[model samples]
Every structure is written in C-alpha cells, then in structure tokens.
Target chain A: MKGAVERVLRPEEIPQACDDLMKAGARLQMTYAWFPEPGQSVEVAYLAVTAPHEPFLFLRCSLPADSPHLQSLAPQIPLLGWYEREIQELCGVIFDGHPEPRPLVLHEGAHPSMPPLDPRYQPDEMMPFTSEPWDRPPVEGDDVQTLPFGPVRADVLESAQIFFYYIGEAILHCHPRLFFKHRGMEKRFEGTSPSLGVVLAERISGVDSIAHSLAYCQAIEAACGCEIPERARYLRTVLAELERLYNHLHYFGHLCHTTTLKVGEAQGKLLAEQSKQINGMLTGNRFLRGILKPGGLRRDLDLSTLPEMLNRLQPEITTYLRSMEETNSHLDRLITTGHLPLQTAYDQGATGPVKRASGIGRDLRGDHPYAAYDRLTMNIPVRTEGDAHARVQIRMEEIHESLSLIARAAKDIPEGPVSSEISYVSGGEGLGWCEGARGSTYYCVHLDDAGLLARVKIKSPSFSNWRVFPLTVHDTNMMDYAINEASFGLTMAGCDR
Target chain B: MPVWTLYGIRRGIATTSWPKKDGAVAQPEVLGLPRYHADRCRDNCRACADVCLPGALSFESCQTGERLALDYGKCIGCQLCTEACPNDALTKSNDWAFGVRNRDDLIWAEALKSPPAEEVTRKIQKYFGRSLHIRHVDAGSCNGCESELQALNNPYYNLHRLGIFFTPSPRFADLLLVTGPVTYAMQGPLRETYNAMPEPRWVMAMGTCAVSGGASGGGYSCGHGVEEFLPVDIYVPGCPPNPAAMIHALLLLLNRASQHVQGGQVAH
Candidate 1:
C-alpha cells in the first residue's frame, strides 16, 4: 500500500487485488456498497490498512445496477462474510458464489419491495412492519440439542439471539442471530446536514459515540481539507483516551460480575460509575453525546476542570486494578479459559483487546494515528495467551497507557482555538477511521452537492469481531460460555447497527 | 485468596446514600430536562425547533401568533435547542430526572402541568407497594440506555435497596421496564416477555427511544416506541436516562413518589 491511493478496478480484479493485499500484510478495514442514485451502477469500495503503519489503499469497483453482483472476497479474507452479507442485505449487492447468503440485518418485517438501505427505497415507506421471525441457522450434530439464548435475556446490555448446538455439555457449533436492534441507521443519514449527522453518527453505537462522531467529522474535515487546531487535536486525544478509560473500566467490571465475585464486581462498578460522572463533568453528557461536530468539537473544553478530573480518576483506578491483580478468585476464573487461537483471531480480523491478547500488535491509534494520537507515545500491549485472563491484562494495560496519554496531552496542550474554519462544497467521499474503546471504528461518508449525505456506510468494530465468536466459542464448555462471552466484551448494538 | 477478603475490608463501604440521604447526585452536570420559556422565545423565531434533531422541539404558526410545543417523550435532551435559542428562552438547567406516572404529563405547552386531578391506581399500589421486580427488555437501543441500566445494579444505585430487583425470568416480574424503540426483529420477543409476566403487571418506557422512538422512531428498521405495541404506564425521557432518574421512574410506578419534573421544568 502506498500513500493515499484510490482507484477503480474491474469486477474480476477485486478478489484478486484483495488477495494480493492480504498477502502483503494488509488487513481489510472496511467494505461497503455505494449507490449515488437509483438505477445507477452500484459502486463498491474495499479499504485496507497495511502492516507497519502504511497509508490507506482504497480499491473501488462498480457493479451494474441490473445485476448488482460481485465475486465474494471471503475466499481471500474469510471474515468478510459478515461484511458481504451486510452489503447484500442493505444495498441489494449480491455476492455471487458466496458460501453463506442468509440475511444479516434484514428480517421478515422489512418491506419486500426493496432492501432498507437501497437507494430506491421511497421516503414514505414504513421501516419494517412486522414482528419478523428469524430463521435459526442449522448447527448440526447427531445428539445436538438446540439452545436459543436470547434477543432478550437476564441483564445483558443489548439484544441478540445465539443458537448453541450442544451434545450434553460440549458445543458442536454456534450460530448467532443478530440485528434484533437494527434501526435503519445508515439509511437515516440521508439528506441531513452534516452537523446534525454528527449526532446520528454518535448514536451508531452509543458506547463508541465519541469515536464514531469524531470519525464522521474527521471524514467531513478530511474531505474539506480542514486542519484542526493543535489545541483541538490534543483535546480530541484526551477525550478519546478518556473514553477508552471508561469503557475498559466498564468491561473489567463486567468481567468480574461474570465471575460472580460480589465485592470485586462492586469495586469495578464503582470505578465504572466514576468514569461516567467524570465524562458528564467533562462533556455534559454521561456518554459524551453531542460534544463532537463536523468541523471540530462542538465547543471548547474547560481547561481548569481537567487536572481535578484526572486526579480523581488515577488513584481510584490504580487501587482497583492493583486489588484485582492480587485477588485469586478474580484472576483464577479468568485464566486459561475461553481461549481463542492467534491464527483464528488474525484470520477473523479481531480487534481491540481481543486482537492484542492474541498477540497481533495492530492498533489503529498507533498505526493510522487518528485525532492527536500521533503526538502521543505509548507501547501497544500484547499477550500471547489469548484467554480470558489475557483480555483482562490487555485492557488493564491500555487503561494505564490511556491515563498517561491524557495527562501528557492535557499538560502540553497547545494554546489556540478548539475548532477551525471549514468550507464544504460537498460532492466527495472521505473515509474516517478511529481506534474506539472497543476496537477500530470505520465510517465512509459521501456528500452530494446539497451538503446532505448521499450515503453513509459504517463498519463498526463489533461487526468485524462478531464473526470471530462462532470460530472461538465452538467446543468451549457450556458452563464457561457466559464467562467466555464476557471476555470479548462484545456490544450487540454496535454489530446490529 | 483469603487476603482478597482483607483487601475488601480495607476498601470498606462505598454505597451511595440516594433516597436515604441527598446522595442521589449521580450526574451533577446533566440538566435533567430542558426548561422552556414560551415568552422568552423570540416571536416568529423557530430557531430552536428547526435544529431539533429528534423533532422534540416544534412550533406552529397560528392566528394568535406562533405556538411552540414540547413533547418530552420525543426529547433526547441533546441540548441543541438550548444552544440554538437566540434569547434565553431555552436555557441549560440541571433537571435530568423526568420519570412520570402518566404519559401525558410528559407533554409541555407553556406551563408545567401536573398529572390528572384523579386518585391513584389502588390495585397496582397494593400489589407492588413495598417491593418491585423489574424485567428489562431492550426492544432496539443503542445500548446507551442499557449501560445506564447495568449501572443501576452497581454500588451507587444498588437498586435492590429500593426494593426493585431485575429478575432474569419474566414470571417473577411485576413491572416490564423496556428500553429502546421497538425494532422489527425484537417486537416478537418483547411481547413474549411481557406476556410471560403474570397479572398485575405494569410497563415503564425508559429513555426517549422507548417513549417516543428517539432518533430512529420511524426509520426503515424500527417501530415507533414501545407504546405502539404494549401499554406503557410510565415514560422516562433522556438520550439515556441516568441511573438516579431510572430509580425515580421505578418508584413513581407504585405511587411511591410524586413527579419531580413536569413538562420541561424540574422541581426545586
């Protein structure tokens, strides 16, 4: 991959080019279909980031609107199965010769006339209109007992149905039915001002709000060639890392909760609650919604509050993590269970702690250097075990790095305005990539002459990581399933959106 | 392993004193509801209404002049309207909690209106007077609401202290506290969960999404709020209502407490 490259290729060259790029140590970052107008040829773009921090290489190919078909790239990168099914269901882009063509985001309730995201969908058409039943994928074995987990269960954060095919206790196969929370996110971005669209993007996955909106704004800024001020960059860095802090805290709290360690769970939850309160003080919303806009930040940060918030965070976090490390009950439950092989992780494009625990040292913050991450220096922690314990270790390590990053960025914060002037002529496509708390988040924004989005495509970190679940969860003990699931810290809403 | 217990003892008590004391200060900076002043709103200026993303703020021109209407159910509390208002008509105030017993009490015209002058539902009060079991369903959410819901079980809120426990099985639930706008795929499961609950049950719509569909209300993949499919007895509005606010709503379900925030105004 070379510096900032974009080119259109014939349909036949897509798979071949993707295969070559994969061989060259490039990982598929995002894939989507773009329809500029109804009845026009469907344009598809495949974005890949090469190893050792190479520039992004964007490869595009147009399929005729009549056929709307392309050769599948799953044969090259097996994890693209989710991406392919998503585009097939939303954009009506048929993946010819693909292995699994079952519906991904769409269900029986969607109007049969057109895919929800199809350019031809009428504005007046109701979203989907029924309590649609999902077809549970067959998980075959002789003594397999089908266990449907949930679209709604216990105290799980979001809704998703996972079918575990089990013979007594050991699992034979796992088939997940997601999109129970799909809300027509991408299609709704049409015709809205980019400033308001920032709000929409933030809601793409509420936990990853800052990362998503920042990426969306970065896309618009990159398109307009607007350079954010140094102060803004540093502030963005602080906010991003702060977000990473809260999410990691939340994930750890959850991990302890899964172990049924009551005291440890409270300790973790206390830390998580403090993070939310801190976020509320810093950004006015607990989840940091509406703080990021297209040109830059929605407003300036109150510099005086930073030292106090950071001071409050450091000691509490350190104390809890220190106690957690020394606690055997907590550590024992996490060790040597829910192991995912490094090869499976890499093959599936697993990200965040999942990828780091498996020892694949690829972090978009360090690699692509979005926001002001390029200004900060830190080590990307990695663990070879790829077990539940390894995931915890990675998150704990990242929390320390994030705290250091925020402190350094805040102290050395440049003296300038927070937001910059941006001029939008509209009629270009730009890609925004950021390392969210969970993992990498990708946004592709295409704007028309009217400054409204022609199309908005997202490949959330959850979308890529969910594919790895079936591959890893298979053959794991039935009783250990909940703990293993907690290990990944998967956000069903992100995947469903 | 035994040392862990010593460590826990060293950590000591961290429980918040909300409902017991004035310790319910969960998110101090979050202004619970957006306070609206119809008079301060400049005549014929629809600036606040125009920029409202979720259509929570709206104005209609009439013979008298222009009338501004606020449906708290539709408000995600992003505060864009507060920023958009040229005058001090809409100001950012700390009024985050807006959990009410009757759904209509959420709507605002000009003044803060109280719930019906009539008496309470004696039957529900009698059934869940002391304790409440809630079964939460995420019809279709961004997980912002769910994150807050999870926090309710944390040390700060410790919801069980308030006699509300989140039961996994709907069979034991007295109230169905549902979040998210009902999505296409989730409709069947949400209804099934509600139906599974025995008689003398109530449904509380938490957050703007479940109350008025939030941003994804009429989109291609979502049904507008839970009210369309099920009977919602309470409506709590926020992008994701904070944990303290969630407790207020749950308490209001059994007539335990009166409405703290009415219309867009929060009580002192």
Candidate 2:
C-alpha cells in the first residue's frame, strides 16, 4: 500500500473498476489473494498500471472468512481467468459465474476439503495420491484426434503435458497443462526473513535469476525506504543484461534446433556458453545467483574485465546472427508459422518480445525504468508480422542491444560500497518490477508484524505469455508446432511457479 | 552451408580434453562447493547453519556433544556459509568437479573417512558395449539443471565425443539423469519413465534439488529429492551442477574417472 495507490471497493465494483482502468489505457498487471489476518478475512488485491512511468494502482476487496465469494472479472478481463482460477483453488475462494472454473494448480490428488494456502489448513492432513482419469473435450470430426504430448517430453526439457487436437498435420486446438513443476515457490517464501526471501526468489525461475532477485530486493528496499549505492545499481544493470544475452542466445540455438539447422544450432549454443563464461568470470557464478540481497549486493564485484571479454565475443555473435538471418531454409519455416493477430495478443495479455513482435511497443525497461535503465538509452524493437519470424527477429536485435548496454554500464560504473543495511519495517508493503529476459516480472512484498515476509506474490512474464501461446497454435500445422514454441521461449518452471 | 562450415572452422577446435586432460579452463573464476575444515571449526558456533536456507550445513548433537554436519548434496553453492563463518572452517575453492558414486560420499561426518581408492579401469564399458544413452527427467527443477545439461552438447563440451547421447526414449537409455526436487505431480511420471527404461539402468541425481532438495524441497507440493522415490547411483551436487561437472559424473558412473569428492572433501 505504501508504494501503490490503495483503494478499497466492494466485490461488485470490481468489474466496473477494471473496465474504467482499461478505458483509461491501463492494463491488468496482476491479481492475487492473501490472508491479511490468518483466519479472519480474505483480501483480494488487483494491480493495474497506466503507460510509461506511472505508479501501480492497487484495488482491494474483502470477503468473509466463512464463505469467500466474488463476482468473476474473467468474463471482461480475459487475463484474470487463470489468476481467479488459481485463487479459487489455492485460497478456497469461489468466483461466481466463472466460465470453466476447474482445478488450475492442484490436480485431483490434493486434499479436497482443505486449501493448502489457507492458514487453518494443516500439511499433515493431506490426502494420499490417487490416479485420476483425464477428461478430454469432446470434438467430433472425420480426422479429429487428440494427442497428449508429455509430462516428460523429449530432450532436456521441463515437465508439462500438452494436448493437441489435430487433423492430418493441421491442429484444431491446443491445451497445455503446466504446473507439474510447481514446488509451491511463493508459499516457500512465507515466514522467512526477507534476506532469505531473495534466495528463494532466485530459484523461482533459474534462467531469470537476476531479474527475480532484483525485483525481490527492490520490493524489500522499497518497503524499508532504503536507497542502495549508485555503483550497485550500475552493476545490477550489467548483470541483468548478461542474463538477457545468454538467454536470447540460448533461445536462438533452441530455435535453430527446432528448425533443423544443425550448424546454426551449434554456433548459437557456443556463443551462449561463452556469455555464461563471462558471467562466471565477472560475478563468480555462471547463472549470476547469490550476488544480490535485500538491500543491494552481498559483496562488491570486480567488473573491470567485463568490457574486454564482451568486446571479444561480440563479433562472433554478430556473424552467427547474421548467418541465421540469411539462411532461407531456416527463414521459410518461421515466416508465416503460428500467426498471432494483434488484437488477440493484446486481448490475451501478451508481454515481452511476444507482445512487441505483434506491434505492442510496451517494454518495462523503457517505460518503468528500473535498475538504472533510466540512465541508459536503447531502442525497443517492434515487428508487426506477428509470426515466429518476427519473434526471432526481436530476440536477435535484443541480443545486440544487451551487448551495448552491458559494455556501457561496465565502462561508466563507479567504485563505491555495493550494499547498505536494510531495516525491516512491520506492516510495510511494496511492489517492485523488472523487465527480465522474457518480459516484465513483478514482485509484491507484504511484511508481517515480526518484520518477516507474510506473502510474496510473483507475477512472472511467462505466466502471461504461456496463456497467450495456445492462441497462436489453434489452427497451425503440427510440423511447425515445435518451431512456434521454440520462438516463444516459454519456460514451464517460470509459468508453473 | 559452406559459409557455416567456414565459420566453425575459423573458430577452431574449442572442445576441451577434460576427462583425459586437466580441465580447469572449463570453470574459471567460478566458485564451487565450500570446503569445510573440521579442525578450524569452533565449538557451538551456528553461524553457518543459521544462514543455510537448504539445511546443507547444520549443527547436530553427536556422541561428542556437538558437531557440524556438512552435506554437499544439499548445498546450492551460494557462498553464504563461507561468508557467515567467523572461523576459517569454511572457505571458497575452485574445485568444481564434484561427482560421486554414493549419496553418503557427499556428507561430512567425523567418523566418516575416504573409502578405498577406485581403479580408473572402464568397468561398465563392456556391458554397455559402444556408447551410453541417457534419458533425462525433470522432476521439478528450476530449469538451471536443464540449461547446463543443454550446454553439454555444445561445441566446448561436445558430450557426444565422450560416447554419451541423450535419447528421446527411455527404452533405449542406459542411465536416467534427474533434476529438481521431485514435485508431487512429477513423482508418478518420473517413476513411469524409470520403469520404462531397460534393465541394468543407473540413475544420476544431477542437482542439489534432485540430490537433497536444494531450496524448494519438503514444501507441500514437492519432496526432498529423487532418492525418496527412486534409487540414485551418482550424486553431482551443485545448485545446478555445471556442464563439466556433469561430464565428470557421467564418466565416474562408467568407471572412466575416479570419485573426486569423498565425505564432502575434495580428494585432489
């Protein structure tokens, strides 16, 4: 509430408020439920944001502890569908008149009566695991067939099942059931010191470690009203860009692998490994974990050698990207594959490169300007094709921009203390956000009376994009499914968590 | 295609002769598992244990009053313990090659000592004949393990050069490599994959989560590690063990390399 403009409204006013916010050119950032007081009342918070550099608008409504019910906003705001379903299952809140209000995170094996997130529920009271038959949607046609892909897919990949209904190489509908990797990450942050909360945040999505921890630290810092050193801010920018470079490179390689470009895949992956080596050299960790804390950084890092290393790797990466762009065989498969219309992308709440590729130029780095991004200047690339090729192009251009940002930060960074003492304040709440490699990641922190974390709600970029992914696969051919998926670079761990 | 060939050739041979030669180049300026010196530890000090979020280091009441129990399998290599220690008991090192054949080999106890030195003979080579196929399963990892696992096939590592391939089917796999904390939803699928594999198959836990549930273990949704539901033959314990460490672990399983860490101490 301290960092956000807080307002209290009744359950019935939620729909009209969301409509008004959308009319004012604001979008739904996140919607989550938490127990303000353990067993007394259930509070639902909705966060909305307007264009560039606007503070978040927080809307709250209370429900009775005995029977928590709310008018479903998913009918109007399509983005709230999954969030409301998750809240209904995990927090035991009922959304009246909701369409398709089935189980989201918990399958049938979980305890039927007890909500795990409810403060009154006990962990030992969980029911035993029992196999349940999956119910498939009835579709009638001559060539219609349902194919269940995986909880365990081929190659080294995360676990999530995908249901594809198709006819002779053409897909009719696609349904992805994720959260098989949900380790209850947000629940794991409860009752822990905000310092330890950063550690848990880093593990939320391993590839987005710096972005997740940075957002978590900024939340704690904002709650305490502490300003970190200038040097730490610049170093944080460098680390975040390094993460972006490796991730985009990996995305490029995986895209190549999907397109059957063997040479291109090897070249792209080699460049990614080199970028990781640079991360290890500068931060002492390949994934750039454990360097960030609540206040600032745990220790000062020596980054004098970063610019030189980046300078050496830039040309190889450039040539590799150029070669991939020139290859017609690779470009042919991606040009018109998995086309997502502009209106559908915006309506489904797409973010990051996916949204940008569909001609929505919304980037939190240029808009919100967190972690020293305000000081650095870079162009946000946008493509109007709304296809796999456009998405790949956005990432390629982003890799070039990330390299320049890292080099500039390394050169202009000042020498000073990297951290400050964090004095935790009770009953303080703050929201922090960062534009990670994938998209914008938001972390909202609420400290309890003992100054420990009561609730930490993480709205990952993948959660939005994963919801938008199936929209593109509705009528696409099965041959291009893997390529379309590779271009999106969606991580199940990030979305499931 | 010709230009691509030229580009790759210009870069030259980037692969490292790791298992045959010293492979320090693979992990430069990187911090590995913290080395715990038993003699340097002070009595009744909980400095390291208090900050360990994953319970990798804890003070247990032993027969001799109190002792620090160190388990590399549970360590995430975050360097928090090394910074929290008042004494010089825990220090940072560059020994990234930590792959063991036994789960207990990763734990440090006063009564524990290094087992007999193993011969570097290729014991399992004849059984598998030409090459080894691996079927990787993600129990509930953070995706860091999969990231590093993908790098094994890169030009620098070129995992295929070592006669190991990641097959798409478990039926053709000789070893099952697992990552993550074995979340509840994945428990059944992981078992199904293992059951589908051929006989004489070995399992390798590739990360701290798969070894002893690094950060998100024991939560309401996930268990501690794969050992709870599956038998593991090797434990390579880093937050997400680096690409080179995974190669060492695979070779150690094949008896091509000796165990590097015993009872949480680097043998070298």
Candidate 3:
C-alpha cells in the first residue's frame, strides 16, 4: 500500500521514474500512449509494478499535437523496444531513439498514408503499403547464414515475413515482420456505436472471441459505471473457463499432432471435443458467442442442461486422461524441447502458461482475482523447467483445475437477473483486465456523452508473449517451429489487431 | 493386434446411413436462425439489432411506427440477440437446414414454421439411417475452420459414426467442404479442389467469412465469395462455423432436398 507511488508522474520525469522503479525491483509491466484525438497530440503512460503485488505505478508523458514525439525508453528498459515501435505505428508517436520504426500492425498500403491514430486522417485517403525492398544487409562471415522462412510457408496460415540468421547449429539472430492481416479494427471503431465496438473486439481474434469480448465489455461497463448481475459474472467465468479448457486441450492436441504422436493426438482431440460439446450445450454456439453483454449475460443457463453436461464430462474427461497417460513417447519428445530459461522469461515479461512453466506463479485469475475467481478454490500449476514438456504438463493440470472451477461455479450459481440496465454519462475513462485463456487481456475505453465509445486501446496476451517467441527458438530447427508455436498458443490475429 | 481387432469388431458398425435415412446421433444443439414469438414480445429492445455482426436484424413498430426486419444471409448466428431479448421472443433452433434456392428464400422475415408433431417422430427414426461422405479443402482459411473440421472426428462427435468421413482425394467425395473467402492466391487451388471431386459432388461453404466474406472478403487479396470461383451447394454461415453446424449442413446436403444445392449446379 504505497500511496505516494500510486500518483501519476509528469512526462519529463518518466524515464528517471522508470529507472528508479526498475532499481527499486519493480517489474516493467507495459507502456502505452492514449491520444484524445488523432494527430492532435498524445499523452503516454508507462506502467511499472512489482511482481505478486497490486497498485501499479503509472508515469505519464505528453507530446505536442503537431509533433507527437517522445524520448525512447528502449535503452533503459530493453523490453520497451517492441512496445515503443507498436506505439509509434499505431498512434503516430515517434519514439525518437527507437532502433526500428516500421509498421507493426498495418500493411504497406492499407492506411491514410501519414499514421493511423491521426484524427484528421480519412478512410478515402488511405492507401495500401507493400513489402518490396525489405532486404536486409548481407552477412560477411561463413558462420552467419541468413534463412528466409515466410511471407509464405507451410504452417503459417496468415502472412508474415521472418528472417532467421544462424551461426552453425545455433540461431544468431531472428527478425519478424507482421501486419499481413491488419483489418483496421481500431480505426473502424472511430465512428461506430458502442455496441458495434463490442462486435469489433470479438472479431479481433476469432479463437479467443469470449476473452476479447469480456475484456471489451468489462471496459465499457466500467466506463459507464454499470454493475452486472451476480449471474452474469458467474456466466462470464464459466465461458472463460470453458474457453481455457478447450484452448489448452486443442494446443496439447496440436503439439501431439505436430510431433506425429498418433495416440496422443487422438486423446487430445477427444478432450477438446468434449470441451466443445460442453460449450455448445451451454450456449447454442460452440464458441460461446452472444452470451456476454456490456452489463450482463444475454441469457441464463438452463438448469436441466447442467446435469447432462456433468454426466457427459465426468466419464469422458477421465477416459481422455487415461489415454493421454498411455502415450509416453509423445510426452518424451516434448520434455526438453524449446526451452526458455526462468531468467529469460522474467526479463522478456512472458505470461500465461509460458511464465508459469518457468516457475513464475503469476496467474491473473488467482493473483488479480476478477469475476467469480475470488470465490473459487483454484490451484496455479508451476514447473521449474521452462520447456515444451512443462508447458504441456501445465496445460494438462489446468484442464483438471478448469473442470473443478466449472463444477464449483455451476453448483454455486446464485439466482439473479442475468443482466442489469446500463446507460452512459459524460467524460469517463475506465480500464478492465481479464485473464484470457492465453494471459492477461487488458482493455481501456474512453466514452463520450452519448455513451458511445470515443477511443479504445486493447493489449492482448499475444502482444506481450510474442516478444519471447523468437528468443525461445534460438537453437531449435525450422521443423520444430509448429510445436514451439502451438505450445505457446499465441494468436496472430490478436497481436495483429 | 487380434484383441484390438476383436474389440473393433465387438463395437459393431459405427457408420450411419445418412441421406438415405437421417443421422442416428445428433449434436445436442444444431445451428440455425433464431425463432421470434411476436405474441410474447415487449418491443422496447433493439439489442439484437445492435449486437448483430452483419446488420442482420431490423425492427419496425406499427403502433409506434417501427418495424423489425432480419436478414438471414447477414446473420452469423452469434446469438447476442438471444441474450438481449428479455421477452423470451427469441430462441435458438436445432434445425440447421436453412439453405434456400432463391435469395429471397434465405430470409427469415417471419417466425419459424413448426413441423407437424407427428412428423417429429418420423424425422428422428429416419435420421438414424443416413450415411454421408465428405471432402474438405483448405481454401486460404486461417486454419480455424480446419481445426474445428478435424474436431468432428473426435470420439465425442465421431462424425464418422454419422457416415461423415473426410476423403483425402476428392475423386471419391460426395460433398466438398470449402473453408475461407477464397483468397486471390487460393482461387486456383479452390477450383482445383472442386474440379478434383467426382460428379454429383455437393459444395458446402462453411463459415460466414467464407459464405459472404464475413470480414476478410472486403480486402483486395480476398475473393468476393467461394461461389464466385466455385459452385457452392450449401452455405453454412459463421466466422468459423461450429463443428455441430458443419455436421448438420453436411447432413442437409446429403438429404438432397435442399433447393440451394440442387439449383445453380455448373458442369465442372
């Protein structure tokens, strides 16, 4: 409870404050900029907090409307490099000292030419950008060999350009260039209604629809000071847990499938299918869409269906676990592959299963405790080995934890209205964070008088975790890429959006 | 090995004689448009219209000079409307066979017409007798569709038991499952996939993004629709259509009763 630390600081003092905070043993959580209007100017805020603690210290900085430029913090905090580049690309704010300042989320010709966050920018003036002359400087030494994997590759479904440089069997350097599936989601939300913004958020990532929607809805509700019913919170938790259960199962299955482990693949598929069935039964849609509203849930869970779900899940999950246990060869392959050391994970700010596997017991559900998570008795699984096998083990254990959470939530659900009526007032800004299946998904929304969304900035788990992906694949082969990617369960759509 | 074979044999025949009959097993909730009950309506809400991703819902009140119209083609079946409807006027139906021959027929302007009570029993009995063979193509999808498509093979769903087996080579396929909005690059491959399939093969367009380019279609690289490049038999609308809905669509295509699948057949 450091009251003085909670106060926001001015722009010029941010770098020093960040350094002091880092020296004080505070983790450099994240940094982002908020623009009141595009091209008018921007106020940048850097968030720093110690691990296993709440009440983050926020340092604020402002830039002139005409010249949206700020001093780069990358030299001080190494993690700020990617965040700075993203801020520059999205908000048109120049981190003057940034090493690389290319577009992170927008394609070559898709935008209004100048920068996306500028309010003066019009849709008609937008042009597409191409990636023609991105050829890097040639290497001299014999040991340094450059390998270009994609823009087009076998495993990659979306478009991305990655260049991997290797020195003998070890990867010396790797650079990722993305923005292939940029749909201008943030720009599209500018003039739309608030309700429509919810849809936009859900579509940010097709797979993590509920998580994105929940984060967006929470932000909206907070901005409007709306209180959701008890049932809605319970429902939200159920949907989130279901998503986690399915995602982890699917990820495990993908890992197995990538390794060509037949029995493990089959077992993973069966578990994932069971999760899907539960999802379909609860909501008419398998992905659990339409259930989350700004103020509450769309509908109440049908009581009769609960018993059926229990009956189906209990026996099925048990059998699935047994089958997975029988497949030891698959487990052996994943054991020490794609290792990320504990120190590296901490330095890179890795979250979700990646962090937990590295023995950092930081789960937003347990640590932050939002929605119905506080009431539920949950176990946060951690493994000392930060390898693919540890990640697999964490996922498997979490599935059981999710089952328990779901069972408990279903059993203890209170009787109440599924939703509460919500209306908007003027000049409100609110932040909401939800522990998505992957990691902490944060949403900040500023609303106008009409209760419509004015501006929104979303930071998905993938944005934070993508920083560590290439780092972990330092010595791994190209063939192990899918296994490495699947183990992390990072969504390019979420990051790109 | 012999014991495993014996176990396989003891499990009996898992294949369903779909289309000839109906599927023996059904997903608990099949995909379709929502049903509205005007009688139970308190018309103060436009939440459904607001939450609809594709501008599918429109409402008008006569007394208050407003009217509500729903465009089935635009609906992704996200069901946010069902959550917002306080009057219990909207409910999700399991009847996924919503495809139509005419564009006008695809619209669900009025409340759903219920089948006769006696026919429900007959339909259930018939469902157990149908069998279907399917072929799936990865037509520039984000692989979300492919993931869900594979899940249909899992033990819980076990689409194979419903006579739904995905054929690798299209020559033996009864239906062609296309997933994605047909990207410019994949346009050739999509046509190749369709052309490779045998005669009397039906094309089932899965996902809203694929059906009418839900979001990705408007891009320069994306094709207008799967039908623009290939002859589609049935349209299963969703961003990435749920596996249950996918199964239902396959079943409907197998029924050979859908006019949408029957009409608009170009000789490949």
DockQ of each: 0.69, 0.70, 0.19
Interface RMSD of 2: 1.7
- Give candidate 3 regions above 4 Å deviation: A1-9, A51-53, A109-111, A123-126, A129-177, A303-308, A315-319, A322-328, B1-26, B35-51, B58-70, B80-91, B98-147, B153-205, B213-235, B247-268
Error of 1 at B239 (Å): 0.7
| lDDT (tens digit, per residue) of candidate 3 on B1-268 | 2432443355344433543465644454644466656566665667677666566677756676666665555566666677677777676655444444233444554443333133422442364346656666644454457667777776556676666676656677666677666644445446765787766566777876667765445443455457787777567765566665566666555553433312111111
For model 1, residues A25-144, the per-residue Cα lDDT tens digits are: 788777888787668788888888876567788998888888888888786688787788888987888888887767777875566467667667864367545655666665565777
State TM-scores per candidate.
0.96, 0.97, 0.80
Report the lDDT of model 2 for residue A201.
91
- Give the number of the best model, judged by DockQ: 2
lDDT of 2 by residue, A42-151 (tens): 99999988778778899999988889999888888888888998899888889998976677787766654666677555542333466676554567788789999998
Locate the minimum summed-lDDT window of 10 residues in model 2 chain B: B116-125
Worst 10 residues of 3 chain B by lDDT: B259-268
Which should have the higher DockQ, number 1 or number 2? 2
Cα lDDT for residue A383, model 3? 98
TM-score computed on alpha carbons, candidate 2: 0.97
| Pairs with backbone N, CA or C atoms under 3 Å apart (clashes), candidate 2 | none
Top lDDT hit = 2
Task: Evaluate residue A142 in candidate 3 and report its C-alpha lDDT on the 0 to 100 scale.
Answer: 78
lDDT of 2 by residue, B199-249 (tens): 878899989999988998876788888999988888889987888889888
Which ten contiguous residues of candidate 3 chain A have the minimum total lDDT? A1-10
Which of candidates 1 and 3 is the stronger one according to DockQ? 1
